[model samples]
Target: MAGPLAGIRIIELAGIGPAPFCGMMLADHGAEVIRVERIGGRIQATDPLLRSRRSIAVDMKSPEGVALIRDLAKDADGLIEGFRPGVTERLGLGPDILLGDNPKLVYGRMTGWGQTGPYAQAAGHDINYIALSGALHGIGRKGEKPVPPVNYLGDFGGGGMMLAFGMVSALLAVKNGADGQVIDCAMTDGSALLTAMTWGFRAAGMWKDEAGTNLLDGAAHFYDSYECADGRFIAIGSIEPQFYAQLREALGLTDDPDFDAQMDAGRWPALKEKVASIIASKPRDHWCEKMGHTDICFAPVLSMAEAPEHPHNAARGTFIEVAGTTQPAPAPRYGGTPTDAPTPPPQAGRHSDDLLGRCGYDEEKIADLRKAGVIA
Candidate 1:
């Protein structure tokens, strides 16, 4: 069967980082996303984020190029762009004009800050955005500086994924007789929303304001990563009583008097040191053999190179080879409408002629635009 978004069409203003990630998600699920690249743009065919879409290059600096984008967006179901608040307006392709051309379009705007705020036009990255959201403050070990999670929380999770969700929801609303709308997805706002459960915990007085002192933030003796003899790490989370019993049994720690007080917060530091010493006595493989498939919520920490090779990941087809690049497969599988394998990432302007033809431009017009350096 075709994928769920089989009939959806999107116009994506080509960009780096999270915006491309959002487009990738949409295209992976069968949206016909037409990526509008800048003329003479650099091409990286191995970029997984650029896979599963057709590309057409255009010079946004020219009036003809702006007109071309407006033409292509006239019938698009949605459009996604990542730029400063007024950048699109300066380019003369803002939401007011595009939505005028296609009233049913879902115009998704991605930014580190929302369209209207003091920092709306300020330069920032994933680290700064998460820092402002209080998410960064809660990460890292107790009494240590906050460790940025390599941009995962702010860029992909909070930014791209949030924009994708907003686009889909707005599209659904448009389908249900609602007018098209703009989704101002800010990484700061999205990252803040990601801390919803933590907020609840704080409100309930079950969490600490200090980093790494919370129940799930590596302060608990029963939930943290420990290094083995070979210097590899294994994560353990035996939160419930039954699981903690299983963990103790697996580690032969049931008779240890120190482990008797499982939830004693005052004893956590001492107990954690003891658990670390025991775990350090053996290699990761030994623990895996004893507890991998048990209910102790145990897992060996795997690096990016090791992750795809793991048995569980292989069995689940969590990664796939595309264009000689090994990367994560499209997720949240659909049982009734399975998506096909993704197409390879394209070079800039690879589909220029085809896209122009689809937009009702004849060969003469396409050739003229190409000759004028408006498209490539």
Candidate 2:
């Protein structure tokens, strides 16, 4: 089988960041995603998000190019774009135009802000979007400014993933005889949704509004990362009483009264210092060996380079080699529709000739368009 979405096709308006990520996810699951690029553009092969798709390059500003995109989108199951709200419409490739040709097309729009918000047309990035959504405020230590989580929260985790989900849902609806509709996916909205659990905790009085003071935040001694002797670190999550007992026993602190009040906020700083000192006395690997098999809830902190090689990750094939690049494998493994290994990102315009041919443009016409600077 060609994975779960074998027959599905997606038309991706080439863009940086989240929009490409959504296309990658769809293509990874066996959807035929055609990425439209600028005539002279080249794929950044190092960008794993651009993987698993064919690319067709055209001068999107040209009428012929816009017409080409509309024709391709006419039969596509979904179309994803990340330009600002009115950009596609200006190019005449907006939902109204494309969906008119393909009545069952799912048009997914990605933006940091929604189409008609106060800041809708304002320029922004992942940091700005998440900051507005209240997700960034809960990320850092209490005394420090909120450190961005490397753009994961707003871009891929929220925006791209949300668009992917919207596309799949809309396609499913189309399969069930429903007409396609536009999906307005804003990173801000998705980022706020990502904080649903935090909202619940705050409402129930189980969580503090501050960053570092909450149960899962870095302030909790039992659920934080501790630096070890060699400057490496380990994470701890001995949250339950039984697990906390195992932690205390592992550190030979079972009889210590200072740690007796596990939930007392006042004792946390002192307890955290003690735990840090203990962890610092040993190297991360030593502690990993000591508590690796126990219920102390431990894991040695690993960088990206070390993660794929970890025993657990290797055993599960969580990462795979793609075109000589070690990248994450397809996720949420399917029992009956196992996804195929992903193809490397294609060079821009790599499939232009074939794609145009498939779109009903003959060889002479394709050659003429390329010569006229409409395609590459």
Candidate 3:
């Protein structure tokens, strides 16, 4: 607990995917994030997203467990949940009740379609969410069906990160003497927000609505990934004039008259074919050796196993070992107040007694709750 948010406390009602990711983000920055899990939830030790949390398990089906959450929230600066809109309210632990208990609490609600949209109550995943936001539509190769970018777009980037930002912003507002408020963060909304720059380009006619037809969407010959002789890929992003010149020089295309019209979109298909043929003539390492240090905006495609071991990543300490697993380190370094190394993921209910005791429940009461099967 050594970061800018050192003193902040958050109670996370245990969920999956983005909710845990949000909790990890807050905990990484030194917020005290207590994750409340079900009485016997499985623990995922190697999941980096669950690291740095103090786990307390409770059977929220019982009145005692619901009351425990409310009690915990009374002293918490924020609470994040990823249930459907009315789920928490049904549990009697919704924002209305929590904020009543603690007027300064920031209640963050994470969802897919939003709290009040037509699709709010519908079931969906990252692909569906991004699809609704016009994000997934613009993603894929030309003349191909849209390809999902795993779950990064909707789950992590849009959903979890947006909720984390909203939580911090609301917590700061509470510190400034403002009353607490509920944040309704939806993945659909967040994904659209992430595409703001793209929307601007479209509005200005600088972007085409078709997938893979825009400047930054893999249509340009100078900004795409190419296969090497060894079947590996190298990504190039020499968009700017000077960088394109550098790319031409590095690829020995400077003397090729066909490569002169860098911005001619009509010529991109043929130029891309030419570039692909040249890049495929060499191995990935050959291109890496030739242009890795230049301003060509080039990089060899790396797998998850290779990324952490790369010299640049190792030199920057971009990844770390936790619980005998290699994972990304806490990011956006704070020079003045650095964050501590992450603790290992905890077993469900590992800190149940400890957290309840801090909430003023005596050891006997905690034991009673356990005996009654309210807490585990």
Which candidate has the top score in lDDT? Answer: 3
Per-prediction TM-score, please?
0.99, 0.98, 0.99
Residues 1-376, candidate 2, lDDT per residue (tens digit)? 1689999989999898999989989988889999999988988786789888989998999999999998889878899999999999999998888888989999999999988889999999999999999999999998889999999999988899999999999899999999999999999999999999999999999988889988888888899999999999999999999999999999889999999999988789899999999999999899999999788888989999999999999999999998889999988789999998888888999999998898899999999999999988
Candidate 2 at 199: error in angstroms? 0.4
lDDT of 3 by residue, 1-376 (tens): 8899999999999999999999999999999999999988988899999999999999987899999999999989999999999999999898888999999999999999999978989999999999999999999999999999999999999999999999999988988889999999999999999999999998998999999888999999999999999999999999999999999998899999999999999999999998999999999999999999899999989999999999999999999999799999999899999999999999999999899989999989999999999988
Q: For candidate 2, what is the TM-score?
A: 0.98
Q: In candidate 1, list every pair of residues with a backbone clash.
A: none
Error of 1 at 18 (Å): 0.9
Query: Model 3: what TM-score?
Result: 0.99
Cα lDDT computed for each candidate against the true fold:
0.93, 0.92, 0.94
Winner of 2 and 3 under TM-score: 3
CA lDDT, candidate 1, residue 51:
90
Q: What is the C-alpha RMSD of each candidate to the true structure, in Å?
A: 0.9, 1.1, 0.7
* Model 2 whole-model lDDT (C-alpha atoms): 0.92
| Tens digits of per-residue lDDT for model 1, 1-376 | 1489999999999888989999999998989989999988976878999999888999998999999999999979999999989899999999999999999989999999889889998999999999999999999999999999998999999999999999999999999999999999999999999999999999998999888887899999899999999999999999999999998888788999888888889999998998899899999999999999999999999999999999999999999999899999998899988998988888889999998898899999999999999999
TM-score ranking of the models: 3, 1, 2
